[model samples]
Target chain A: MENLKKELKEKIIEALNLEDLTPEDIKDDELLFGEGLELDSIDALELIIILDKDYGIKLDDPKKGKKIFESIETMANYINENRSK
Target chain B: MKSEITHYCQIKNGKVIFDENLLYEDKEVDFQKFIKNAYQFFELDYRKFYKMDPLCKLAVMNSSVLIANLTEKLDPKTALLLTNKSACVDIDLKHQKSITEGFARPADFVYTLPNISLGEISIKNKLRSENSFFIFETFNPEFLITYTQQLIQTKKANAVLAGWVEIAENDYNALLFLVEKKKGIALKKENLLNLI
Candidate 1:
């Protein structure tokens, strides 16, 4: 789980072009939108692609993504349990 | 009312010139790195810049300097007139390649339109004004002068942000100017051409 979280942070930074941030800058429980990382709907779409393409996790329902992508912790936990790859 | 070109920004090669004053220059790096440097040198607070396509990035950066130098707040009705030779072709080609390879990203799909650059500038500046983009064989300062006059005279807009931004592989030329009804260099063909 710890390794998955670290890898997720790196992927997020590269995929989102968060040029000013490093893996250390993001906390496990930090919100991905609004305040912490300030991501938006577009970024949410990009994250969905990452999950589908990289982790083999197809998120069919967009509403469930809100809870699944709440933080690095939630994403890592969800991916750990659901990722087929 | 006679519109005048108040201020202008030019980004050519790897240098940034505003109102005919050199503000930033880095001749050593490529275009992508040059934009990143320009973003930092200008001290822009907008983080969404990183997510933009290259054309939009250049447009936003060029307009931002003029916006920052405004002596007074921008009138909400200020219009935008953007003319470019190579409208978003840089991203269009990349997106085409990504699709041919079977891995097109949504981000790339969203920026396929040239007007998205104007949209990005509007969103960044928080200006809810009329905006238009035109394609031309080259920079057309004459059109800007006439259109600016029409908008100001008709009260459709108080000011106009007119620009010509062209970006291609290993080459880029961007010039953005603010036009007002009065109080700057007279918006004449000679004066506008001199900046280019």
Candidate 2:
């Protein structure tokens, strides 16, 4: 779970172009959408692709991703539970 | 009072970036290679202009290079004067294709507006100054010189990036100069040809 959290943080930084940030800067329990990283709708699209490509989870609705991707903790939990492959 | 071209650079496909003194007879650009280099150089990995809008791409390419070369930072008061011949023709074609086809990409529609390229540059650089886009069959030195001088005289801008940026279905030519009321030589609007 901790390794997944670290990997998720790196993916978020790369996919969203958080250029000023390093993977170690992101906290596992910090909010992903707003205060923690200041991500937006476009970041959400990128996260959807990360879910599909890495975890084999296809989110049909981006809104559902809000609950699934609220924080690094929430995301790792969801992916561990629902990953198809 | 008049502004001068302190520094400038222009480049065609696979050529060394140079200024106006270096004559470039070759007008051909490897569109595929140019597009690829531009994407890599600018880090614009997004799906914008993937269908090959040469004009839009030219704007992005030149602005990227220019910004990279600029020694000074741009602000809201910086005036941007963009001159182009074919303004968003590629976008127009895409819009027509969408009408004929079942689905029109909404993103293409957004780029169809005539001044979109200019707006894109301004947004990319966060420049909020007086920006203008002009269309002409060829370079009008008289108007170009006059307008640039007047903008500075009127205090609309501290610096002006003025030039002819012409692109077609597959070709592009950019003549760019950074003008400011600083430690640069001054020339009358009528003497532009001689100065160039």
Candidate 3:
């Protein structure tokens, strides 16, 4: 679970080109949207791809991502519970 | 107050890809060959444009190169006002094809928005100021001047790049001018349109 969260943090930083951030700077419980990271709808789409490709978790509707990707904590937990591959 | 043409470049087709040495006179020239020559000089680094709708590609390519050259070191509060026609018409066609083909690419859909070109230019130039794009059947020099002046006078921008950029399947034209307010050169209304 720890390793998956770390990887997820790295992927988020890379896909979004958050140039000033490092993996360690992303707190596990920090909100992934709005005030914490300020990620918007488009970034949500990238996160959806990351979930599908990295964990084999296919989210058919983008809206479903709000709960799964609420934070690094939630993402790690959801992946641990439902990742297919 | 008026601004002088301190720096200028005009590229057409592909030959003058990114040449900063292009100079235009009041006389009309073979715009097509000029564009072709401009293309030959610069190879597009962005592959996404190749896959974009053709009209979208033309608009993106033209604006991208100019913005790339003009803002190598961006001036603060620079405004942009551009005009075009049949914006992303080709993209609409491709979008329809995607629906028929059973899968639509998200990236293609993103470019289909006409305003995306303005965003792309702003991103590339690091310009954060008054910006607008218009779709018109033909060029209107008066509108371009008025809108650009408003941006400057309202403090929304310090300088403006204004022009008409039109592209169809086989036809394209770009007439651009960099405008700003400064001392020494008094900009007269009568000669404004003829400057570019």
Candidate 4:
């Protein structure tokens, strides 16, 4: 779980280009959207692509992303359970 | 038709010049690093800036400098007329490579058209009057002058953001002017040529 969270944080930073941030800067429970990281819809799309390309977790419906991408913890937990790659 | 050059921004050779004054310059940096430094210097927090290809990033950076100090809100009647030689060829080549490798990314695919930079500017500034992007073999000041004149004379726009934004290979330059019916030098082809 700890390793998955760290990798997820790194992936988010690289894929969404949180250029000024590092993995340590992102708290596991911090919100990914709105006030926390201030990510927008486009960042969400990039995260979806990251999940598919890096983890082989395909999300056909974007709405599911709201829950899975709520925070680094959520994304790491979801990917650990479902990642094909 | 009478119009004035209210404001302008020129980015070239790792330097950003606004209204003829040198704002930032760093010749040693790579293209991406230079752009990132300029964006940081401007203190711009627009997150979507990262997603833009080099051409769009250049356009947005230039326009952001041009409109930074306006006391009044931008007129919705503002039109954008931008010209470029390469016309998103840089991003197009990247997208083509992605397709050949069987891993085409949609984000890259969206910027295949050069005018998408105009869309980015309009969305950021909320200017909805008129906008067009043209491709020229070389910088053509006469056409820009003529088109800007027509837009002002026809009362189609109260202001026109017109300029040349060229990105070829690793080299890039953006020269943009805000044309309006206000106090400034007359918008002339010679003046535009001299600035570029």
lDDT string for model 4 (B132-190, tens) is 99999999999999999899898889899999999976688899998988988778878
DockQ for candidate 4: 0.38
lDDT of 1 by residue, A3-83 (tens): 999999999998888987899999999999879899988789889988988899999998999999999999999999999
In model 1, which runs have C-alpha deviations exceeding 4 angstroms?
A: none
lDDT over C-alpha atoms for residue B191 of model 1:
84
Model 2 agreement with the true structure over A1-85: per-residue lDDT tens digits:
8888888888877655464478888887888877766675656766777787778998987677878888899999999998986
Q: Please report how far candidate 2 places residue A31 from its true position, in Å.
A: 14
TM-score attained by chain A of model 1: 0.98
- CA lDDT, candidate 1, residue A17: 83
All models, DockQ values? 0.68, 0.06, 0.04, 0.38
> In model 4, which regions exceed 4 Å deviation?
A61-63, B70-73
TM-scores of the candidates in the order shown: 0.95, 0.62, 0.56, 0.92
Q: State the weakest 10-residue window (summed lDDT) of model 1 chain A.
A: A12-21
Candidate 3 docking classification:
incorrect
Model 3 C-alpha lDDT per residue in residues B52-156, reported as the tens digit of each score: 444444455566565557644556587777787777665677667866875454545776866676676666557777778898876676687678767777778
The CAPRI classification for model 4 reads as acceptable
Worst 10 residues of 2 chain A by lDDT: A12-21
Worst 10 residues of 1 chain B by lDDT: B101-110
- Which portions of model 2 miss their true places by more than 4 Å? A1-85, B13-28, B41-52, B185-196
In order, what lDDT does every prediction score? 0.88, 0.68, 0.64, 0.88
